[model samples]
Target: MMPDLPEQKGFLEQEANQFFEESFSGFLIADEKNRIIRSNKRVSAWLGISPEEIKSKKISDILSIGSKIYFETHLSPLLKMQGYFEEILVELNGAAGKRLKILINAKESASKEDGLKLIYYTLVEASDRVQFEQNLQHGKSRAEKELEAERENVILREQLIAVLGHDLRNPLGAISMTVGLLERSIKDERQKKLLQILKRSSYRMNELIGNVMDFARTRLGEGIVISPREIDLKPVLEHVVEELKFLFPDRKITVDIALPEPIHCDADRIAQLASNLLANALTHGNPQSPVSFTASNETNKLELSVANDGEPIPESLQAILFTPFKREGNRPSKNGLGLGLYIADQIAKAHGANLSFTSNEEETRFIFAMEC
Candidate 1:
């Protein structure tokens, strides 16, 4: 049940009086005729008058002429109609006729039995109010500029993607097609070899473009987007091995995959990741010793690894191996931008997996593992 309103009013009034007495801001109680009946110590200090001497002073006597006119003309009528007026900017006549800018809040209250009215006033320095408003405006402006810049950045990235996907790829596609047509007509062995070189260069160029697009999307755009579904992962692995074997004909790549059931994954992305890892192994591994490709899907887990016999990756480089455009400084094969491993790692991450590696004097192995 609600407490009696008269009792609540009495309790609230006592609390309000305590609050006004301890407040840093000036407080005053005035009669209906605007004669000050009581003033807090803060008001006495600002006015350079004793509390007892401040009593019986008219509110207009302490206000600047302009503020006195404003109080009588606007604020007084507003308070009478609404019973309160808050945050009205005004000026007070301080000691020695100095002007003090302030904000005042005044409320009119009446005694329940006698109907005698009293006005309570709260005074605060306007300097703090002005500073707070300035800070708020500055923050709002900064946020708006940042939001606009982000929108512009998004537009630029989309344009980059369109150019990479359509404009650049279309020309590269034409070159590949023309190379295929010329190979059939060429008869001289030297000419044929040159054409073959051109073909391989085009293929490499296309691969580099694909890597760049994937990097931009995963790092700059949203992230590696995947269409995950149940897929026969064994065939996907086998295809990647076959493709890499064709590209690096002399380098042997041994595979051991045992996925007895369909695995849930983004098959094409997984294939791309496998191809990247395997290609990196072929490029750096000891030619005489075969690169090892292994995978297994068992008991709600999927794991794949590519191992190559090589000198150990440097400890410093290992820490930043998955970082884009970073590579082993000591390594010799510097064919393309160092994005292959970075893209591979991104693909692994897209599938809720992590790509990790360990290196020793004997071999370097990269592994991708996740819950299926």
Candidate 2:
């Protein structure tokens, strides 16, 4: 802390007056009746008047009409009781009819025995300060408008994505049905094989559309929807496995399910989450190893896990494993909109459950646990 000042002799009236005349502020002294008793050269120059002329005029003569009224109604009563006021905004009616903004700090300097009182005032130019604040407020308003516009554009883009994803569904369904019918009637083995390829490609496209729709729904603040009921999880798991097994006949998917009791959850949504996890395993797991699914119900919860032997995921990737559209750029061969895990996680959350994972050199596994 800085040391306090030492006591010293005060300047005499002549020295004080001379210092006041040379000060930067517009300095003035006025009596209790508001007549100008004295003013410094700074104030005299500001008013475009001589010092003698300023002394001859009332202080109100230099004030704008509004400030003169404010001074009488507010500042005078406040100073009378409190003996001082600081940084009060007032305007002066300039000699050329231009109004100049001023910041005033005033104090009661003397209260004589004869009931005469004197006040000291320092006036500062406030036009630049007020203009700067206005400019700052305008800039803030412009920034807010730009932000709002950007938000609206994002909403429009999400709406377009949702519409496109929805419209593609009917055509995709027709294509799948047409291909299935052709596969059943085809006599040539080679034509049958080509039909299978078409069928698989169409299914992949359909899955991509579904993921995009789910992602758009989430962005629009509509989370996954589920209808709860007591249902066996075994059938849901089997259905997903059987379909995936049909698509990838060369790969093996084995299921081992033993439920302690019926689960209270959304059966279709459970199937979807399981399907997504299986797809991830099939796409990323080593082709030589089979993907394994095991599900069981404990006394307090129903648990399902999918495991595959593959190169372990990097530790950095685990942090964003369930985030939407967070795919590794290096894996260009992978086909997805990167929404499967995110949608599965949302589904699990909607059912008041959690999706978690573990990975090492041996295998990567995803677990879904739902409390009863």
Off by over 4 Å in 1: 1-29, 32-34, 37-122, 185-187, 219-222, 228-232, 259-264, 283-289, 298-300, 311-320, 325-337, 370-372
The per-residue C-alpha lDDT of model 1 at residue 97 equals 73
lDDT of each: 0.86, 0.86
Backbone clashes in model 1, listed as residue pairs: none
- Report the C-alpha lDDT of model 1 over 3-33, residue by residue, as the tens digit: 6799889999999888877788999999888
Q: What TM-score goes with each of the models?
A: 0.66, 0.87
Off by over 4 Å in 2: 1-19, 56-59, 69-85, 94-98
Q: Write the per-residue lDDT of candidate 2 for residues 1-372, one digit (tens) a residue.
A: 865444322346557778899987888888877788888887777777788988857667789999999988898899889999999989887656778889999899766988778888899979899899899999999999999999999999999999999999999999999998998789999998889899988988888888888888888999787899998778778888898997888999888999857889999889889989999999888888999999988777888899999888877778998888887566434678789999999999999899999999989999999898
Q: How does model 1 score by TM-score?
A: 0.66
The per-prediction tally of clashing pairs is 0, 0
